[model samples]
Target chain A: MRTNLMMTAAAGAILATGMTTAAMADGHATDLTLCWAAWDPANSLIELSKDFEEQSGHTMNFEFVPWTSFADRMLNELNSGGQLCDLMIGDSQWIGGGAENGHYVKLNDFFDANGITMDDFLPATVTGYAEWPKNTPNYYALPAYADVVGWTYRKDWFERPELQVEFMDTYGRALDVPANLAELKDIAEFFQGRDIDGTTVYGAAIYTERGSEGITMGVTNVLYNYGFEYENPDQPYDIDGFVNSAGAVEGLQFYKDLYDVGTPPGSSNWYMGENIDAYRSGQVAMQMNFAFIWPGVEADENVGGGNSGYFPNPAGPAGQFAQLGGQGISVVAYSEKQDAALEYIQWFAQPEVQQRWWDLGGASALRAVVEDPDFATSQPYAQTFLDSMAIVKDFWAEPAYADLLIPMQERMHNFVIAGDGTAQEALDGLVRDWIEVFEDEGKI
Target chain B: MTYSPIDRAAAKTPDGVARRIRGLSDRTIAWIFVAPTIFLLLAVNIFPLIWTIRLSFTNFRVNRPNNAVEWVGLRNYERILTDPDVWNTMQATAHFLIWTITLQVLIGFTLAYLINKKFRGNDLWTTIIVFPMMLSPAVVGNFWTFLYQPQIGLFNYVVAFFTGVDPASFSMIGDVHLAPWAIVIADTWMWTPFVMLICLAGLRSIPDSIYEAAECDRASKWRQFWTITIPMALPFLMLAVLFRGIENFKMFDLVVQLTGGGPGNTTTLTSIDLKREAFEKWRTGYSSAYAVILFVTVFGLASIYVKALNKVKER
Candidate 1:
């Protein structure tokens, strides 16, 4: 009986300690879980969240997954009712389906209540990723990281007077940054198989990953520049013309031609990692990638410090265009801590915090912060990226966008790697498959 | 009444013992012994299988779980059956299975036969021959990928020296026609040693009396090999084929690392395609059907092969 009484006393003490700790953490609404792509930038965001924690007095947990598994992981977490995350950084392409499926917390009321206006963000960033439809009032998320397609080139190679003279003599123009696809191809061909600085280098490197989003990201630049649209303006999935349009075929053919003459052998199997390695190793004269790679290119001794230059994707006959590639912070609709998650977003959206984010090599989504001279001067390529952010166009903002993208990616990889079919044939096949997906989903 | 109590106590002892003995039937006792195992099987195997079978008939997407699940009946199965791309993938898988199993059996048997003869360093030779199977498949796949690299890869360097073709011009993974063969070759290289070990065990189990009897009969070495050794090892060889066939049918990790089912789905086996659908596309119900088909095919084939192996053993 004495031992039992002592055990009861010990249990009481333990329960009291637990209750006290809970009370300490309980004043603020609840705990919030945030998910994002695992990378150095993600680490920086985690470091920056300490101030939010102090001010809000709410505990925040983070779940970081690799880019390859980010979407699938988030979807599974939400589906399983697993309480895996309260807030997530989702790919832009996922916003439509995510909103339609009710995975995201509708943020319009929260924005209104907080006196937060979406106009405070870059218009393209806001509409492209955060809004459900173009310029729609039903916002499902807030733009967290705004990225767009851009190109990096070897400035040192282009500046060589002798090479410039030879290039001009061969192409009948002074060698400069390409203003169009034709010029880009000409520059690529000129530098192909050239021995520079006692090392052999190729002209360009592009991703051709058969699985995941590699091909989509790489091919969209050409597709959009050549006026490829996912659907008709009047009807969904009625892409008979835009998908297999003559200009789009020309664009695909141009990519294939560039691969044939300018890319290093085995380039067809390259992905993002390969692109980064090739550029860092100085084996390629140019690389087309998103803004996320800028910091890596700038910091890496082999590619960044003094050897790199950035440019917007060259214009095509139709118009100047770049594919929008960015991520947004969405609160999981199933989260028990919705209020705390919203408070975190509000805290994160503050201009002062965003400026600190910029100082830490983060891409800012706020127009006010991004336009600040102080933020622009934080890094060398910040202003360049801020300028390019103006012209970005996102493809397929519908719920069935992922389904439409799969067949397109497969066909693109087939065209580039196997050369099994003409660009027109591949694009026509994509149009058929995409229409099927849309029809099945009742989106058309 | 006093006398009845004493008699009742005497009857009770033997009656109680007999009742206890009769209560434990052989089947009941046996079940009691295996109850834990039976419970485990139900928990781990039967539950998931029933769940998956149910899921296979529904239209479910991982991303849109809250949406209503529609019953598609056999729609997924019919689509898989008629799809040309799926058929092509099956053909690739069959080609890989046939080539790798044939190569592994032939080479493994030869190695085992040679090692069975008591020569200098015979034990050492046996250990060295089985080393490849001991390493992880992922490690083997990564190493072989390096060796197949077109420019600086050792295989390409050696081939280049003989053929004078630019090593960098050809890609093993990028070529649709060559990617499947690359996977088959790597699998055969790693697994042949397993077949060799099985063959070695079979060879050892055959008594020296048979060879001695053949010698007494004045049979030639070739005659003895054909009449005695081959017959004795047939059962083990068939067993090896059964094991290897079932394994190669579901081949995934090595091929995923090597070619990633790329070059336009040319090297995509059914397993790779199923993974792409289920995980990558989040089409859970569709891929569940795909998985069920794969399961049935493998299970059906393995059952027939096992029966044949039993027949061989009986002979």
Candidate 2:
């Protein structure tokens, strides 16, 4: 009887200690770490996060890696179950891996408890960035940025009378924003090796970067419009015809043609940064890049003002589509300060905060902000951003996305840049590679 | 009793500790001294190697820890060996290895021979030659990209000057045919001095008496070079080859920063390919198998080379 009484008291004391610790934790301030790629938007986020810091009385630390190494570094951190990041703005392609590997906290319940609705966000952003099974209501993250592949052109040069007349005489069309990929090609060809202000300029700076995801991101913008589907709509993983369709081959060839006859010399391995440099330095008349660079181009001394114009990727034979490029913010499963991280998400999802995010150079995915009546006229590229997002298609968001991506990068680079094999052969090889991957994954 | 500082220090210890120390055997004391190093080796080196070998037969992914692991003996090895792309990468590596070694050795030996002539500004020339070696491989890779740039690059301009070709017509890193050579040239430029220093050491170690004796025997300079210098420095030359061969086989950063294994895998060395498999693809077990194959190839070749080196030394 005495032993039982002592045991009960000990248990009660332990319970009291637990409650006290929990209460103390809830009352105390936390140092939350948010990880993302170091870019202009990340800087804007830093400025915006200061408000959250003051409101919550919690410190916010940022770990921003460069675009090239961000995935490798951050993914490694997540896979190792490192507690470095309480919040992560991970790439969209990582959604499947993040959810499957339990690197991200499932936000469905969190959203319910916090009155955060996915309906308030853009459908494409939700589908691309938040949902793992894609289009399913199952949520792993909240859409943080809305970005898509878009074009920036030398509007000043396009408006020039001599160039316009010459372009019209050559292509038999007004040199305006290309209504289609064919017209875009004509523009690119017309601008190739043209003299502008005593400097020889090239047509465009397209992504041909071999490392990481640059080329894949660039090529897919063409591929999707040319009827390159990831899989058959009726049958998941049935991609033989869909991936290597005749239209897809044409798309691949078109991209290769643009690469060969359009881009500047030594642009065989260009990416976003390289393209930006090419455009800013007047080496190229047009640049294909993500919409996020629009603001930077608008602010640049050389390419800024009304000199540059933005447009969504022009239509192709099959349809109009752009490659999606954005990330979603999620609470890392390994984080100890998940409550604080969730609070931050709740605060970020507010309409007012999202409006401020847009104002501060963030590509806010909130429909409440983007769908506002004044949003289209907010910035010169705002309408282009909207159009691009509407037509955005993303790469495979499978758990094996890296495997899928690496092969595509190799095949695309080999065919397009290395001048190896035919376009059909390249796409066929990719099909075989992806099939093997799917077989290994037991998804075939 | 008179004692050393260590002994005095030991003597100041508590009686129980002192007694225990005195009770230990010489072997135990030796083991006590070596235990930490042994433990470290086991933990850092031997353990991982053994673990890697064990993992080679399984289908385990590091990123998908929740997934079930399955044993698939020799499958990864078979796939790697039979894959044409793998073979292509191997060919690229071979091309890199052969060219870099041959070029570095030839140029290095020549430079070392010239420097050993002990002319004016010899130290200055040697220091200048070694500057490229002193810089980080990553830095060399980065700057060389600029140098190899098509239009504004000094290298392209120099080539154009010699060949009378347009400066902007060809891209060293952007063309498949030239990308391999681009990495080779950059690597040779950066690492040639390392080989030079080794050859210089070897050259310096040879005594003047040997040359004097050769001259006394009515041997010509060419004969002395072929007979005395070549034979004497064979081991060092072999040593330099062995080091450079191994280093070039695992070359990653310099080439990666230069071409990123492109113009479509023209410069994709096995190290870069293995990195893609291991980290980017997260195929841990498959990459472990890949690593094992590489380790065995390197070990077997190095063993043969070392045997030859020992024989040369004996001669």
Candidate 3:
């Protein structure tokens, strides 16, 4: 009787485990996880997800990695088939790799099924964040955030009567918001090293970080404005003449000149944080950074409110442009709860949710939300952000984007910061590196 | 009445369970106890290393793992061996290893010798000297960047005060010529105390009777130092050198924090280059070959050094 009882108990336990697994696999309530960089915007996003949780009855979990390690950590999770993330806010450059690797759920069908239309998003954002095999209409993500390179300058310094007269005398132009790169350089030169209120201040702080992709991102702003194209549109991967053109070389030289003479001491390794610190500490006359930091800069005690002014990236020889900076939201393909994740995206795409996203400090990629007349007047830098987004270009989002970015970073940093060799030579070497990598990938 | 915790725990165990444990042979128990550790070692260390070695012979990529992993025997090795960039990194590693080890051993041994004198407040001085080593290297490496700043850094201000040169005229981390030495200085500052602690132990281990006998022989203080102290402390000094040499070779975090092998790759060590290739560039096979070469170089050199250390200890 005891033996019979033991066998009966064992069979019941196995059957119960099977039934529970089946129950969970059926349409039961589930927990969904979202991952993103640990930034101010991520906090706003988490706050916004509460409503979704309440209605869906699925508690939303978040894994926020610091920006420095965000790519490394999240990509590792996706590549290793980890189920830690149901939703991901991936960088714009990650769309190609994520889509190609099947790490992200292809969202075209989902969007169609849910009445979500790509025509609603800004054109640039759709091309930048949502498209895979870029310029193609295949959607793998929803454009969640949009940002671009822009400038913030000390308005009080430019408005000083004596300084304004001196700048005019020196550069034959009034001290005001620069209309082009030449005027920007002139203003930077004028303020390179001057005493202000018993403190010696330097000129502008620009990106020059060496370890990662700081210089490439910053220099590309100037490069794009000066006619630097990654490849001939007709012939892909042919970067020889386009990337190393005489105009591109001049632009790179101009950046190098600014870095050498205008920047503060130890500015050779400055990036976003360093630029923010320099601007906030009243150590610099101007700072070039992304729009995300503008809110913080305007709220700063030292140089904020009417004391600071913001503008789009000044034009170069060929035309004006800014490097794109933003990310898109995608559902991880490996997630078991992709339906719930897709539901979250649909809810997030609502116009009301988008308006709240912007109001809560998250940059909105939706045209309807940002184009609201009240939105431009919302903050001091909002108009500048809208203007900058109009002429934005993005870096390559190829699956092997790192292979392309690392060489440019190394070459640009070596020339710009280290002051080694000419811009022509650096660009040539970069072309060689790109071609070699492309050949290895069987792309050539 | 006098039940210890272990005894009480054993007493509480069921008789059948206790009897079963006791029935196992000592060898069997030892094997059971050792099994988990061996398994962990194989899982963590040996398995990954073997996998890396196998992948080193293939044309593979971490990011492109779905693609076919083509076997190109010795091609990855060939490229790494012939690459000038790899050579540059090796040169940098050698420079850092040599200077840091030499400086640390010299400075650490001298301080250890002084502290071993049993002077007043010796313990306090030891604690003060050992303080820098106790702080996190990441923190030290980061703050050192500020300290090396040309304009507002105290380091530059102090240098200006002494040398009468303008602080804003130069930057330690920004200049390629000075960046390597800047890293050398930062690493030495953080690690010299570790060597000093080891040397201090060596110093205290020497019996006082030997010095007393030397004094009876009418040996002068300087002579005694050369004949007795130097020889006796040699083994410990070598140990410290070996430890520091191995450490500075694989130096990643501190240099990354300090210079990031920057100012035009002036300070890019092998480990930094390897990391860039592996994680940053995602060149798994190429970086694996690089890693294998570095492992062989370090392991072979360390094996020989260990043999020498053993000989010194025997003496």
* C-alpha lDDT score of every prediction, in listed order: 0.81, 0.92, 0.88
Q: Candidate 1 on A39-92: residue-level lDDT in tens?
A: 767887888887666556667688998876676677677656667788988888
| Candidate 1: residue pairs that collide | none
Can you tell me the CAPRI class of model 3? medium
Candidate 2 — which residues are off by over 4 angstroms?
A: A1-27, B1-19
RMSD in angstroms between candidate 3 and the native structure over all alpha carbons: 9.3
Please provide, for model 1 over B235-307, each residue's C-alpha lDDT reduced to its tens digit, 9 standing for 90 to 100.
9998899889989998888887777677777788888888778876677888888888889999998898888
Name the docking class for model 1. acceptable
Q: Which of candidates 1 and 3 reaches a greater lDDT?
A: 3
Full-model lDDT, candidate 1? 0.81
Candidates 2 and 3 compared by lDDT, better number: 2
What are the runs in model 3 whose C-alpha is more than 4 Å off? A1-29, B1-35
**Chain A TM-scores, all candidates?**
0.90, 0.94, 0.92
- Model 1 TM-score, 2 decimals: 0.90
Q: lDDT at A410 for candidate 2?
A: 99
CA shift at A155, candidate 2, in angstroms?
0.6
Global CA lDDT computed for model 3: 0.88
Question: Of the candidates shown, which would achieve the greatest lDDT relative to the real structure?
Answer: 2
Listing every candidate in turn, what is its Cα RMSD in Å to the true structure after a full C-alpha superposition? 9.0, 7.7, 9.3
Ranking by TM-score: 2, 3, 1
Residue-level lDDT tens digits of model 3 in B1-315: 798998999999999999889888989989999999999999999999999999999989988868999999999999999988789889989999999998999999988989888789988998999999988878999989989999888888998999999999889999988898999999999999999998988888889999999999999999998988888988989899889998889999998888878987888999999998998788999899889999999999999999999999998
